[model samples]
Target: MSIPLAVVAGASGFVGQHVVEALRRQGSEVRTIGRGSVADATWDDPGAIEQVLAGADLLVNLAGRSVSCRYGRRNADEILRSRIGTTAALGRALANVGSPDLLWINASTGTIYRDARDRPMGEVDGDIGSGFSVEVARAWERELWDAPADVRRIALRMTIVLGAGGGAMSPLINLARIGFGGAMGDGGQKVSWVHVDDVVGAILHLHRHPEISGPVNVVAPDVVTNAELMAQVRGSMGRRVGLPEPRWLLEAGARIIRTEAELVLKSRWVAADVLHESGYEFSHPTLASALAEIAGRAPRGLLPVALG
Candidate 1:
């Protein structure tokens, strides 16, 4: 049998790029269908999106406006609209052209969970947060649940991805390399995160294991607070640093980053029970190991980003 084909909706984004690489590593023929791609059609054009999705063996929908900035009312509206619209459009397309029994992986976020004071929020946790991110996630999932009958679907609720570019660690790494690296806010807020490599791996795992459906939190099995993360990162960068950026300073930094300080400096220790329970093993689940690998320091037990 010939290798099956896969199409990633948001093919050019940070996470989407890694997902593409992962799919290719698994020997799947891949295609891109997003705004900036060389493809002539945007999903917004009538009958455009469905045509692209009709015959694919697998579909990974990661399309969305970037959440990297402070979301005012307008930005938040776009975020929700971009995701919901694409999802609904895809569903309509599948319904029309007769979709195959293929896996449809959609993007959700760990921020949908409750406040971080709860610490290590598990997958089974009933309460979800109600911020702008949460709104985008809830609407995205709703579209998937309401999708046409032929599409087999899974929602990979992602955590903050730590990678060299366009993920959590990039900006922080740049700042740290410049000696501006310090723990933001009180440094007490938990920030559950995963390496971008792991994000790609988790996506491919779900693609292979058809039973892994619904909302699987794609985060490191271990949890780390802001201070601990900062400390480990500083050490990895070879800096003996303890300079703390107060809450107000972080608020100012937020203005420059366009994203709010609360979003970045806030506590959110999300758990990975679903991914773990599904037999997904993490090679870099802890802060030290992840940092070591990212910093070009050789990590012993972990699968390096280069490996992914």
Candidate 2:
């Protein structure tokens, strides 16, 4: 069989970088689309995108403005536009040049679900939430599904991704190091997370199992409350104390840092129902194991140094 060709957009991002590397290691030829000159095709040129996508077996679109900042009017607009515009552009290009065999896995988010402290949200029965973030997620998936049915598509609804160099882990690690990594608010909010490796693994699994399509939750089976999460972070960092931040304090701190408090305050209780039922085992299935692996690979000073 001939080698598979994969075209990845937003290949410069943290998750995209990992996906590109994984694809390359699997011996598949990878092409990228981004504003950067290094990409095979830039998003500005529809013709170039079509050219790069032609004859490609897979297309992974991770293009979006990072949501780590304060969701001001301008930031919110950019976030929505970046995701929807990129997705629509790709959809249009694929409709014009893509083959039926091509698989397009687009990035979605578990934040699309309501702030659920009640139950875990899954692909089948998860209640769609409202607000700016949820609307963004909904619109993002809608764009993917709006694409022609002949082109296979999977909306990978990922939760908070934990990795060594970057991702949601960085801020938390920083918090722990600075003695501020305690429970935020009431600490009842569920933090549904997945290891970065599992994210890549789920992608590969979904690619091989063509039977699975639609919205698939890319989260680990294990979930934890905010208190438990921070406790683990403290444990991982060998910190004996972490100053918990109440809601008011958290909101104030969020304002000071220019980020939305909803990032930590929202109870994101999501379940990897499709991934579990499909028999895709996770490398870092538990919070402890995930943190251990991340801590191992993390920078030297991030964690407490051992003393004799």
- TM-scores of the models, in the given order? 0.89, 0.96
Q: In candidate 1, how many clashes are counted?
A: 4
Q: Largest TM-score belongs to which candidate?
A: 2
Local accuracy of candidate 2 as per-residue lDDT tens digits, 203-288: 88888888988999989888999999999988988887899999999888788877888999999999999999999999999999
Best model per lDDT: 2
CA-lDDT, candidates in order: 0.76, 0.90
Q: Model 1's lDDT to the true fold?
A: 0.76
**Candidate 2 segments whose C-alpha is farther than 4 A from its true place:** 1-3, 302-308
Clashing pairs in 2: none
lDDT minimum window of 10 residues, candidate 2: 299-308
RMSD of 1: 4.8
lDDT (C-alpha) at residue 124 in model 1: 83
